[model samples]
Target: MMMMMQQLQESPVQKNSLFNAMDRFIGAVNNMDQTVMVPSLLRDVPLDEDTEMSSLKSGSDDEESDMYSYYQLLKSIRVDIEWGVRRAAADERLQQQESHKTLSRRGSSASTSSYASSSMSLSEEEDSEDEDLQKQFQYHLTGLQGVLSKLTVQADSLTKRYKKEVGIGA
Candidate 1:
């Protein structure tokens, strides 16, 4: 009986995990925004060792060590997630690509035996590529859940670190 109620509560979260993840991350950023009243105080203060280790692991834009940058990044991520900015742009690009493919296909016909055989092979390759893409998307979706949680914690940690630096509370 208890399990059924728990499952019912979790059903909506499972249905659209991305929105919930974004909501969690955005809420954390909003909390950080209120806590860190004076952002300048975070200017030169470096993030924690965990962030340093993450920078080393990711080895790209994550190389930034300053707390101020992390603060800005958290806000930026909040905006991006809240708006689905990247996803919308990517969807537009994909639509354009699909339209182009449709136009090109309409201009051609596989009347020849050789062309028909090659088209069949190309379709098989496309199927395999689609499967690969699906796998990658699923993997990224799983990663997105963990990453959202981590970013929420990072936001909280930053707020706490800022408070400590400002001698507000320990």
Candidate 2:
């Protein structure tokens, strides 16, 4: 029982498992899907001997080392979320710009087709295509917004967990 307890307390299996889980979490966060459920990223905090060893070499305390690890992880997560948010916002802006250009082109085409009755059918087809494009763009924008919301929630949860672990608040 003592041997088992020791193994459980400081096992390579646990560390490797945690690393694999963290990698998967990072990958899923990078390629987010609104339709799929986001996996819980938080795991039971293991006493990280590796971090402690490195910190010992640098003459830092245990608490400082743990806090440093948490800070780095949180920083990385924040950067990734920010990047995803920025990308989605940029995509939405580009879509809006394209929609505006399409509208302007349609306006000009309508004015010219006023005299050319034969091209009026083509203009109607273009309008239908524009509407379809707009719908598709809106759908993508909504999905992105959902993804952003999920990420925000995940970040908030992580922050709360970190605070709890560090004994910051009730």
Candidate 3:
């Protein structure tokens, strides 16, 4: 037992901010699981009318999902986070070779209008794309922050709502 304690003490510290956030997220989700014992109670409870996450379940923009679905979604997200599963965005990591081929075709075309329409060099186009990529990074970061904020609120709301439904009255 002393050896085990010393081995544990010798382990490196987890000072990374991302890891800290993940730890908090996992703890909150665990709390939610404990609070929401009877998930059937959440079946028809509607989430915020904005329906952002529900839309993701279907192609339709105005899909109606109940609190139960949201609960499952949150749990699945927690699993993904815990397992370090990362998914790429729809527009992420465009093929640079394909882009270069397309750009080269545009620049080296026989039509004068094609050349006259845009006088930007290939390097300039690449630079422009790089700038756009930077903007996209910032945009995604902002969007992620918003989504995380909403999810946090949803998690707390679910826990509270579950408690109320279960007659715990928190």
The best candidate by TM-score is 1
TM-score of 3: 0.58
Best by lDDT: 1
Stretch of 10 with least lDDT, candidate 2: 33-42
Give the distance in Å from residue 36's predicted Cα in candidate 3 to where it truly belongs.
Answer: 1.3
Model 3 stretches astray by more than 4 angstroms: 1-25, 48-64, 84-118
* TM-score per candidate: 0.64, 0.34, 0.58
lDDT by residue (tens digit), candidate 2, 1-170: 99999988876665445344444455544433221232233233432433322323254444543433443454466465545546777799999999999999899787776645554577787898999999999887666555444444454444544455556565
In order of lDDT, best first, we have 1, 3, 2
Question: Model 2 clash tally?
Answer: 0
| Alpha-carbon lDDT, every model | 0.78, 0.53, 0.69
What lDDT, from 0 to 1, does candidate 1 have? Answer: 0.78
* Candidate 1 residue pairs in backbone clash: none
Which candidate would rank higher by lDDT, 1 or 3?
1
| Model 2 ranges off by over 4 Å | 1-120
Ranking by TM-score: 1, 3, 2
